[model samples]
Structure formats: C-alpha cells, structure tokens
Target: MGKYTQDAQQLLRLIGGKENIAAVSHCVTRMRFVLNDPSKADVEAIEAMKVVKGSFTQAGQFQVIIGNAVADFYNDFVKVAGVEGVSKDAVKQAAKKNQNVLQKVIAALAEIFAPLIPAIMAAFVLVYLERFFRKISPQVISSVVVPFCSLVLAVMAAHFIVGPIGWKIGSAISSVVYAGITGSFKVVFGAIFGFVYAPLVITGLHHMSNAIDLQLIADYGGTMLWPMIALSNIAQGSAVMGMIILQKKNVAAQEVNVPAGISCYLGVTEPAIFGVNLKYGFPFICGMIGSAISAVVCVMTSTTANAVGVGGIPGILSIQPKYMGSFAICMVIAFVIPMTLTFIVGKKKLSMADRVGAGDSADTVDVSAEAGSISATENTETTELNGDGANTLRAFLTGKVIPLKEVNDGVFSEGVMGDGLAILPENDTLYAPCDGEVTVLMDESRHACGLTLENGMEILLHIGIDTVEMQGDGFEYLVSLNQKVKQGTPLVRFDREKIRTAGHPDVTVCIVTEEGNAKDFEFVTDIHAEAGKTEIVLFN
Candidate 1:
C-alpha cells in the first residue's frame, strides 16, 4: 500500500519546497520538521487536511500528527519530495570541542553500551520469566520450557557480551599476524592455546575445583595449570597493551589511546575491533605470539575441557579455580611481551606533513577555542530587537487559542525540534520580541505570560513544558507588570544549560497564532532560527 496520499503531498507542498525543511525525523506518532522559517509554513492548510490529525510547532520543530502510518508517510515524502539528509556540518560543529581522554573513553563506552540495550532488556525479561515460572512450579525447573528459557537468556547474554570482546581480540591480532610466524594458521592455533592455558590450568585447579578435592591429580601433577594460565594472561594482556602503545605512537587521531587502554584494561576489546584494525595496517602478530605460547603449553599440559569462554572478564570468571594460577601467569606474560616488541619495532609519531591528508590545511587545526566567541556572535545575530513597532494587523488577525498541549510558564514540554530530548532554558530572562505593552500577564508567572502589541494585537508567550514546580528559580523576569518595552528590549534572559541539566530542553521561542477564524495573517521569520535575531517572527 502507498505510504502517503495525494492529499498529504498537497498539504506538505503548501508548506514550502523541501529546501524549507531544516530537518525531518519521526517519532512513534508524529512526523517532526524543523523549518527554515516558521512563518512560511502553511499551518491552516495542514490543519485542514483530513490526513493531518493536528499540527503545532514547539522547540522550533513543526510536528504533524499522522498516527500509526507516520513511517510510511515519511518514507514516501522523503523519496518523492527529495528532502536532503540532516546537516553533517552540524555534527562536525558539535565535535570540535575538546574533551579529555577519560571523557572520550567514557563516551565511547557509552556508545558501545547503547546498542546492546535492547538485547539486555530481552535477556532480563527472559530471566524474569524463568524466575516467575520456577516460583509457580518448582517441579517444572528441569522441564523443556524452563531450560529452554534459561538457555535463551544465557545465550543472548553471552552473544551480546562476548561478541564485542572477540571482535576486539580479532582487531588486536593485526600487528603480529603478518610477522612471518610460519605454520598452518599459526595465529589461530596460538590464540586457542593461550585460551586453553588460562581456564584449564589456572582456573581449573585454583578457583573452579577448589570446592572439590582431587587428591590423585594433586599428588601426580605439579601445579600444572599455573604456568599455562600465567602465559595466557600475559599474552592477552600484552596483545592489548601492545595495541595501546601502537595507538599512542602511530594512530593519527587524538584521544583514542585512553579508550583503547581502558577497553584493554576492562578486557572488553571493543576498542580493538571498531577502532585500530579498521584504519591501520594489519598487526595480528601480537595475538598469535601471545595465544600461541598459551595454546602450546595447554596442549603439552593435556588440558582437556574448559568451563568458560576465553574472550572477556566475565567469561574468565567461569573458568575452574585450579587453572586460575596458570591464567594469571599467562596474562602477566602476555601484557609484557607484545608491548615490548611493539615499542621496539613501530613508529612512535607521524610528522605534521604526513598527518595532514588531502591538503586539509595542518595550520587550520580545529577552531574550538573560539567557541565562546562564536556563541556570543550567535546570540547577537539571533537577538531580534528592531526599533520598529509591532505588526498590529497580523497580530489582530492571529486569533488566540488554547494550546493543544498544556503549557505552564515555569514548566515546559519536550518541544518538536530534533528529538526535543534537550531541556528548556529556565533561569535566564526572556526578552520581549517587539515594542509591546504587557496586556495579559498571568497571575502565576509560572503558568503563562502574555503581551499585547501597541497596535492592539494580542500575542502570548509561555515559558516551559512542565516546570511550574521550579517556580522560576533559574529564571528571572527583567520587565515588570504593564511595562512598556521598546523593540529588542531584554524582558527575560534564561539560563539554558541549567534547565537542560535539570532534565528539560532549553528551547524557548515565539509562538504565533494557529486558529483559522482570524484569516489574512502571516508569520515573518523562519522556523529553525538562530539563537537571537531581529524580527524573530513577523505578523502581517
């Protein structure tokens, strides 16, 4: 079935061409649009459309309620109308700010963890279901259903958790893989050996079987698992540490070293997989060297079965106790060996001439240092305070109507811009857009604020989505009741970041009328506007 109808297209076209769209993204129920100019949008045309359940603009985003078929409509609209993708310049603009190594590492970890959320939720659900069934019928514990669910949960947890670790390990294997380590797939064999050495020898004897006494083996074997485990641990650690050294010395990108080191330290290995191997030349020799020694020793030690996997920290815990001593030895050696070799052999740093690829100007560097200057400029550019009086005719024709969603001056809703996940500005003062008299100021400044232009057109502006409880702590009113204000006068200045940190988007902008009863009115400015600008909105 077609996603959108001719009526929907007509409604969209009436707003403006695709160029008018600053950005477009959909939520569960609505197709959100950030417009170049809010005034240019044809809200009445949109409202009149049968397909459009309702329309409104908040946080600089125009939201059209399309119910369950939003996705289909969006797909058709983008394809047929040819709307460009979101601005990459914006993302680059955001990334220019300097972040410390730890912050970068945390950010990377957060990104890695985000994708696994759905899987985690699924696993947790399975766990809960299993528990619920077990509680209801203990005898059913061994039944197919119980074990089936338990296995489902376990497998999901292991796959989502261990897959990233394995990918990391695979990534670290690059540097050493091609170093003439002769033999049929010497790398794989070595890694397997290293894997066996840790769990079978170190863990089996020490941590796993500590509860069970195996006297015959104790008497016959001379703490066999210790050397193997030590060798494996050291090998794996060295492989990771070697990557870190190489990254510090060789990688072009800054701030990656910390994340690489942390990932290695946690033994997670995601940094290894997604980062190093993707860009650089192969360096798997370190992994083969580490894993090979561990593997050979395990084969020699007659290592049989493993209780756990070899990839991550959690998997390591499931290994037998007896082999733990060996695993520790392997880890220690692994860390020492690969790093020493990498330092001795690899290039430490690339020259500036080499670093600047594609003539992208080495001297240009990044201009994030000018952020404060830029911010000030942005504010100045976006502040709209011309000496001219209000457009009284547009204002009078703009019929006042109750907001579709409840809005309080102190409280605010997540507006339509972007995800609207951002918090609204609360502390700073809000200025009057044009020359106007305070005509309809609310009794509770927290609920709503209203102003009337000198030309006798009533316009209302609200503060927040739902922050009335705050009672204007971060916010301060600059103008008094019934005060006359010139154009561009600062009526209120709001503290945006504080309100955002408090868990609301700091987007506060002019809201014009939407009702059709008052016809012949037009909005003046673009929808997605700069921070402050003259003629923020025009009514004609």
Candidate 2:
C-alpha cells in the first residue's frame, strides 16, 4: 500500500482492471490470474514491464512474473484490487471447499513430526535416564557454569544449525522463479532487463515488473528471475567500478564511482546509472555486455527460484538449489566482464563529465553517511585496572546498546557468556568497535564476526537472531580474518531484509566474550546507540 500503490494501480489497469479477472493468485515469482477475457488485457503493455520475464495464457490462466518480492507485491495487490489470493491448486479444486487454517496447520505438523514419532516413542523406555542423571548430579551450578554453558551453545548453534537450514530452504526454493522473461526466453529477456531496466526504473515503469514476477511464481513454481536480477545488478555495480577504475587520480570520477559501486552491490543502481554510467558513455555499454552475458548463462542453465527479492548478492536465497552453481558462475561473469572491459577500454582517458553542461549533470544524493555510522570512540584508550596479575587493561567498545534478551537468542539473553550489548541496527553495515585484528570470521554464514583487540579484549558481533539458519545468504564480509582494522572500519554489509524475511530478528549482538571475571564488565543496555560512536561496554 505504501511504496507499491501506484505500481499496483498501473498494473491492474494494464491487465484490463479487476473486472477482467475471474480470480487472482500468486506464486514465488509471479502473479497468476484466471481471466474471463484474456484479449481485453494489453499484451503489449504487459510485456513492456521490466520485471516481467514473459506472459502467457494457459488453461484460461494469465500469468505475470514478479520474482522474489512477489509476496510483498501480492500483499499490496490484494489491498488495492480487493482480489483475494487463491492457491496454485486452487484452480484445479475450485469446486471443492478451501482448506482452513487450522486443518492446514495440523496437516503440516503431522508431516514434520511423523518420522520423529518412532524415536519419540522409543525415548519413553529411557525415561529412567532422567532419574538416573538427577540422582547422580551435584546440585547448584555456579553463575559461571550457566554462563559458560550458554556461550558454548550459542556458538555451536550458530556454527552447526544454520547451514543445513539454508540448503534445505534453497532446495525448497528450487520451485520458485523470477518474474521476467522466463525459461528459454530469459536469455532474450535477461539482456533486455539488464540493458533496459536502468532506463525503465528512472521512468518509474519497472514497478510493473514486480507484479509480473508475483504471478510467474504463482503459475510456474518459482522463476529463474533471480539470476536475471543478479545479472542486471552486478552489471550496474561492475560497470560503475569499470568506469572509475582508470579515473582514480580524478577526484570527481572517484567520488562518483566508489559510492555508486557500493550502492550497486546493495541492489540500488540509480547512482551508478544516472550519476555516472549513462552520463558518460562506455560504462553503460559495458554494463549491457555484463547483463547479456549473465542473462545467457541463466537461460542456458534454466535457473529458477522461489522468489527474487530486490536484486544483488542478497537475492541468492531466492535462487533454487539446482541452479545455484550456474547462478554463481553468472555472478562472476557479470561482475568481472564489465569491470575488466570498461577499465581496459577507458584506460587513462579523461572523464566524460567535461563534455556535459553542469545543469544537465545529475546531482548525487549523499548516502554514505547512512552507511558509514562507525567512528573511533573517545573511550577506546585502555585504562589500567587494579592489576595484581592481569596483563589486559580495561577498554571501552562502542556501538548501539541493546539487550541480549531482546536479541531473541537464548545464549545471549541468559547472559550465559560475558555480556556487552546489542544494536538494533539502522543500516546493514557493521563496523569495528576498536583497533583490532579480525580473529574469527564465521565463513559459512557471515552473521557473526569476532575481533581480538591489542589490549586483550575479544569481542563478538553477532548479526540477527537465529540468522545462522539462513547460512550465508544475503551476507557479505568486507574484511577477512587476520586482517587489521581500525575503529569504525566497515567489516561487513548485509541485507537486513533478507534476515527479516527469513523469520529472524535483525538485532545485532555485540559481545565481550567472558574470559576472566564477569563482575569486571559493565554493559550499556536498552538504548538506541550509534554504531562506532557510542560506547556499548567498558570493562573495569
């Protein structure tokens, strides 16, 4: 209703208004409709949507591919059109009564627990083990024991529990697809989307693509729309990098390229396109090449997905398991080809900015501050503790203060480990709290990062609650382990939406791992603190 209002209105009108539709439903990457008169719909206008891979009428059903953000678009659609969503199977069983929520819940539960029932029943024979353990155990765990157990479990859960979940989800997501030109048609559509989507977005017509993807998923499982999105996104990002690669000495070009590249990676391409690439010339052409290559790869492999949220690296989750390999290959080609070609082609060349008048120049919206919230803290200096034997001095680590309990993870909430605080992050960027060497970087999932300060403090920055279950989808690590970083240095940038959509909280936990006495630490809590600037905890 908020952002997609106009888009929904435009799409409904293009599809011949709600009156032409007999029923409307959606799947992972598309919007599906049972239309009364398919001829009434403007096929030409519908095909023009940037997000739509293709459209087809099958069995009296008209479908539009929207991609991963289908869910969001569908949510907005039902509100605007008053057309309730049915199911993929709904058309087949239209005469039968719909399955109620309670029945569906019960059925789902049985499906999950049926295999475990035998093991659960067998455990009844071992009920005596519970009494045996209770009789043999010494009562009263010290405060230290509880905290130590918690720390171990948290790390173990994040390390072991998250990988299979993402894989399993990916396996399930294999049925999903992107919205735009799908199947064999994607090669053609991918190229068009990659080359033309930038212009469409500027004109505000790409919004219709979201609707197309919604129906694509509804009608044909998920769509390969994800890889198409990635191709287009990576092209934009790499092209921006390519354009400015040779302009390092030029302050104007560097200023545009650096920020544009970063934003492109985050799935926003306007800065790269309007601000630099389109304004220049070769960079935009390089982007088209990257897009075409990526699209061809996607079509060849027949990639598919459950949904494709906004594009970029984060959209990896929307991709299907079977096609992940091809998608990965596409990403490399998209990023590298354009970057390499543009850099080589524009070597030592003067910028195109000189040719255009200042009035016609695009003004860049300063967005780096929104990303760069980290800075060195005044409390970063180490202070001498009452040292009888300790070599480590107490130092302050800063960021937004948050309670571990609010983090929705049992390990931090119980304070089973040493406590610091967490941040309900305003942005996706994670920064270094102090001068340190990156000691532990959880590679499989980029949700958690750790640093060992020179003054002997080991800090853990855990992103999201239960995010390990997402494995490595939607996360990007900017710095690797053994790398030196200063206070406020950006260590990682992640897609917070990806975590939220996965049913996880985005509360980032900043932990001062308890190594010595717990009483020696005091942490700030329950406040909106700025990252890098606000002191989260001071070890006494």
Candidate 3:
C-alpha cells in the first residue's frame, strides 16, 4: 500500500465508489472527475479526508484540491476504484455530457473567454492606478516613475484581487445576453442586435457578443449571432462599393474607397467604417438597414455558425452545412440592399465639392518660398551609401528602427501593401526619405501620404496605426500633391502625445508600395536612426 492508499480508499467510498466516476484526471494540485451523478458524491465527506484539501463542482466536473500530493492520491484512487485514468480532454468531453443547457452555456463561455480574462482585468486595473499615481506623485518624475510603479502594482492587483471578481462579472453578463438572444422573442432580439451591432463596435460593447456566441455554440452546437455579424460586415463593404461607384470620377476618393471596400469584404471593417462610411453619414445608415433585414432572414431560417470565422463574403464556410443555403440567401440581401440604397441616396446627397480631388482643398506649397523655409539642418555628408551601385533610402523619422513585420497593424506587419520598415518615433515631424514627387496625400485625416522617388521607387509614409479616425486633429500636411521634394524635405508633422492619448500606437511605417525599377531591397533594423541622415533601406 502506498502513503495515500488508505486516504484514496476513503475518498472513493465517500464519492459513491467506482460506478460514480465516468472519467477522472488530475491537474497539478487538483483531482478532476466527471461524475456519473455529481449529487451522489459526498462533498463534505471528501473534504474531510486526510489527503483532500477542498472540493467544488464546475462545468459538470467535481474538482477536489489536493495540494502538491494530488498525483499520489490520484494514482492510488484509480487503482483502488479499479478504473483507468483518462486524459484531461477526455474528462472534459465526458463532463459535458452531464451538463444541462444553461450549465453548458456557462461552461462554454468560461472556456472561450479564459484567455482574455487576465488582459481585460489588467486593463481596468492599470487605468485606475495610472490616474491615481499621476495625481499623487511629484510632477517632476511622475511622467517616468509613476507609470512604472503603477504598471507593477496594477499587474499584482489584477492577479490577486481583480481577476477572479472580473471573471464572475463577465460570466454573468454573458449569461444575461445569452438568455436574451435565445428567449421567446429571439427573432426580434436578433433584428435589434444586428441593426445596432455596428454602433456597438464603436462603443466597444461588441466584445461581449464574442463570449455569448461561444456559449451559444457550446449549448446548441452552433450560434445564430455570428451569422448576423458576418452579414453586417458584408453590408458595410457593399456600401463602400456604392461610394466607389459614385466617386469613380474622383481619383483621390477612389484611393481611399477602393481599398477600404476590399478590406471590409476580407473581414477587416475598420477601414471601411471609419475611413469611408462614417465620414459620409448616409452610407453607414444604409449598411445598418441592410444588416437588419438580412438578420431577420437569418433568424427566420434558424441559420447558425459552427465558429466565428471570417466576417465577410468568405464567412459562408463557417456556417453549418445545412444552413449554408440560408446563409447565402442572407448574403445576397446584405450585398444588394446596401449598395442600391447607398447609390440612390448618394446621387442626391454627394455634391461636386464632396467628390472633388482630395488635394484641391489641401494647403498648397509655393515651391520657391517653402523651399527655403523647410530645409533640414542635418548634414547629408554623414549618411553612407552601398558601394556596389545600390540606391539608399534614408529614415523619415528619428527613432528606433524596427522591421515592418514587427508593426502591430496587420496591413503593414503582413506586408499586404509591400516590403517596408517601421519606426517607434521619438519626434513628430516626417521628412522626405529621398527626392520624390508627392503622389498621394490624404485630405481630411492627413495621416498618410505617398511619394514616387526619382529612382522610380514608390514610398508610402503612414503616420500611425488607425490614426485616420482622428480626422486631422493633431496632424499637419506640409507638402501638396504632385509637388517636387528634395531629400530631407519636411513632409508632415504630427503630435505624438495626441496619438497615444487616443489609445493608438505611434509607430510610423515607411512602405515600398511599388518596387518600380529596383530589383531587390534590404532593411537595416534594430538600430536607432536619425531622420533625414541615416540610411535605413538599400535597393539594388
């Protein structure tokens, strides 16, 4: 007999012997069991045993905390009960069989949001502590010292105090939302939710739907919510397509509208929503109307999704096999209604001034007067070029140079536009990397611009991730469209602090949108660079 043999025997007897256990597994300090009938297990008796520490039932599994000796206790218990131990996954699958609909929904929600719980809790904790620290600390060093200390304390608070409490609250919220959607008036609820979903995204409340959708899938084997969300994305894209058609004569408007529409169809909607639709009020409303109509159709057909896949045209793959036909019908409604409505409304609403070239209203640069005023002070002689007949591109911002792949935004990180590098900008002013003609400049937001170098390389300077939503609040465009610019010419100036205050990273990216004449290129990264004076990219 082992040290825990007698204790294990007692535990088995108290838990209704071998027949009560469907599957058993142990995780570090706990013995997890899928019970045949959880009520048959005497929880008080189990906790009273010498080896068991405490016990609780969760997600159809009765878990008994055994401290560090759980492995030994588990070994003897399985042998004494004459049952083979199963994998933890097997135990979880068996446990699911014992759960009722409500219990399964909660269990699924908990599992799905488990990864995000710590992050959500930490964000709240940090925000509260940061304000408190800034108010109390000495202003001289508060800018540096207070942030560090607040971060340390916030992490501790999140782990020790807030994490568990926040999880309970999140679970409760998910349950309530789940109940509302699956209630007697589910179809009406679906219509309301679908119509308002885009607005909810703006307020950040749409995150709750992710947890609820997982719960629905766990309980009913699929979710009706996700289908509506996918349809909404399609509607948003279709609206942009209508705008593109209306603005077909305006080259500058097409630059933003075409890409924003394509991105929306591929499941990324922010560009379309913030960059185009919200800027023009009617398109946004038309998309919302289209979404609601399709959502009603979705609920009527009882269409459901196996998972939250792509939220656009390709989202059909995520629908259940039997519901694919119904989902496709909903997709057509989403696409046609929004585009038709937007086109009809835009024809009257959009005027010649609204459809004009973006640069027409831009601050024009007088070549002679601005040439003397905006010249760089740095000496160009210090910068080096490769000896082997290679052309060099200098840094546009003074900062730590990093590979484009390291950027947080997927468009740059994944090289969707082209090869490039990024800078964690220490300063606000963006200078020309080479002598080029300004080819593309955003009018309203002024967050990004494009240049075609004398060497035929097309360079795109994007100020910050998602900064387009700022609507030119802290940005200034110094160069106008088609203007000739020499190396180190001041292009655009931005306020770094304003970008951070708006909850966006200030990593400026420089992309080679077109290789043009260059056959190949290489990026020099992981080093600090001086704007207008440091060579960062070599084209051969």
Cα RMSD (Å) per model? 25.0, 28.6, 25.0
Residue by residue across 220-239, what tens digits does model 3's lDDT show? 67888899999999999999
**What is the TM-score of each predicted model, taking all chains together?**
0.26, 0.33, 0.39
- Distance from true location, Cα of 324 in model 3, Å: 0.5
As for TM-score, the candidate ahead, 1 or 3, is 3
Backbone clashes counted, model 3: 0
Stronger candidate by TM-score (2 vs 3): 3
User: Lowest summed-lDDT stretch of 10 residues in model 1?
Assistant: 357-366
lDDT of 3 at 304: 85
Distance from true position, residue 312, model 1, in Å?
3.8
lDDT score of model 3?
A: 0.76
* Separate clash counts for every candidate: 106, 44, 0
Which residue pairs does candidate 3 place in steric collision? Answer: none
1-540, model 1: which lDDT tens digit per residue?
365757657756877867676677776456667666667888867754545645655334566766556688878777766774344334222332333465455444433333333344555666776786666666845476676767776677657864455444433432232221224554454456454433332112223322111211233233223233334444444554555544331222323434444444444342332233222322235544555665554434333224323343333453456656555554544566656654444333322111211101011111111111211111232244434543521111111222323323321122211001111232354555556665433333232344556444444454444434445556545555566765555555455565666675444434432221233454442232222243334445
Choose the strongest candidate by lDDT.
Answer: 3
Q: Where does the lowest 10-residue lDDT sum fall in candidate 3?
A: 360-369
